[model samples]
Target: MSNNHLTREELQDYVQHVFGASYLITQSARIHGGAQKVIYKIDCTNGFTCMLYVWDISSNYFQEEILNEPTFHSSYGSELFSLNTRFLAQHGIRTPILYDLNNDRDRHSYDFALVEYVDGQKAEAYFQHKNHKDRDELFQRIRDMLSNMHGIQRNVYGNANDNSKKAGPCYQVQRLDAETALSYASKHMKDIRKNDKRLLEKLCELEAAIQPRDLYNFIHGELGPDHIWIDHAMQPCLIDIEGAGFFDLEHEHSFLEFRFGDFYHYLKNNDLDPERMTFYRFCHHLSLISGGLKLLHRQFPDQQFARGLAEYHARCVVQMLS
Candidate 1:
């Protein structure tokens, strides 16, 4: 029983209660990835397998006020683990099937989400073993999946949150245009790096040059190798749908470019504006730097690795601006 959250006994009891009295716990293993959440794979005596995601609400990364919101407990909270999964699944995207969600903080300080266990290697590892032709096919499939999600249009632009009985797009922060988004990023950078006026000015110049586009589409906020999983059949399935929402299509494309440099030329030739992509890339870099610094300040103030990441992302932002 680790002190991080629920004890092994408590978890087993919850699983048994959810699965039924006939089901017995067979195995449990911790799966690692994101820093803010803890995931466990649980197998039952009846041969049923499921994933349990425990959110660490005590972490400094989470906003307590947001978590405390009534809607947060509804479609917007741990339910998002299920909501987003179903939303993507409807678009022909492969994602885990959510079984249940428990947000009884009084019973357990952390929130828990039970989902189907996916069997496959992460896309990052799978790609290392593939040939060029195979990798190209996989990339195409990924693009197709992105296009499918983007095809689901909404009139509003913002984060996808629980609206009434269903998940809908809602702007928690207004970013109606390129300039407004850039201004938000600039202010964030200034707040995190108070003494770095030179970098702020450079960011401002980049912001000034951006031409706002009114295009809005559903975007996977964090699309990288880590979140993509490839099954035995070489089919790609996207996971970690937590940060997904309606935003500029260019933002998603730019992130795809930043993470995989090979995509830059392909995107540029396919009608994606070079300057818009660059501006979004800069915004992504700023976000990475800001997030890294926050992690360093709150969770790992004494860890050299956290400090190194913060420095690396800051350097990337500076280089992008230059």
Candidate 2:
């Protein structure tokens, strides 16, 4: 085990506290790909398995100076996770059941949660080898989930934990406004702009064409096959749902299209704001470029992958400008 991660004895203590003293930890392994938190899979002597999520500064890979920036949609902390979990469960969306948590510093130095260990493969991995029929069935269910999720509209925009209620019902908000997005993205677009001197102008032109809307639909903020799990029963379970909230449906669709690529058609909706789509499409790539660079600069464990992402999005941004 790494020095930053919990030791075997600590794991045993946590498992014993939650699953009863009779349950003993058989083994524990770290799950990769989480840049914000450390996740581990724990197997117990009683044949029980669960996931441990640890939120500490050591596990985070992003630049800490801007972690609290309002433009960042991802929420943290144990309370937000619990809130999002209940929010999804109330909507009949499938998600991991949170078993227990220790947010108080007494039990652990940092907040952590134990959730039901889903015995399944990632939807992204599952898609690679599945037959066409199986793929269709899976995509159909995913489309249904999208419909059910987007159908949930809130009077105001933002996450359920947001404290902007004083704005009252009928208040509308964008996940990231154009001005703020441009301000943040422009700083990172210098190299990209050099490729096309008028890049910023073109982006501004696209931004001006965006249409406005008042209704806010529930969105996963960051949804993709990787964040989805296919359990033993072949049902889809949404993971990393802390970013789920009420925002522009287009924001969610933009991410789905980017992540799912060619297969996105299966989940695409006929009615979407074309102008908003155009604008958000740029925002999406810009965010990735900034995020990827941030990760690389912060010396993320997967530096090569982060650099690849940054390069990929950088190319996409230049091409879009053209």
lDDT of all predictions, in order shown?
0.63, 0.74
Question: What lDDT, from 0 to 1, does candidate 1 have?
Answer: 0.63
RMSD of 2: 3.1
What are the candidates' C-alpha RMSDs? Answer: 5.3, 3.1
State the local distance difference test value for candidate 2.
Answer: 0.74
Q: Give me candidate 1's TM-score against the actual structure.
A: 0.77
Put down candidate 1 lDDT per residue, 1-322, tens digits, no spaces.
Answer: 2334667787787887887887677777776545556778888888888888877656435354246534331212465666677778777878777777888777867688788787777766744554878877876777677678877766556556532322432221211222333333355455335535555565556555666554568877778777778877878787777767766676778777766665544333265666556666766665566555556656753556656655666677666544
Q: Provide TM-scores for the models.
A: 0.77, 0.88
Per-residue CA lDDT of model 2 for 53-115, tens digit only, reads: 888855677526236665455555667778889988898998899999788888566889899
Runs in model 1 deviating more than 4 A are: 1-4, 60-76, 104-106, 161-195, 263-269, 299-308
Question: Which residue segments of model 2 deviate by more than 4 Å?
Answer: 1-5, 63-68, 163-190, 193-197
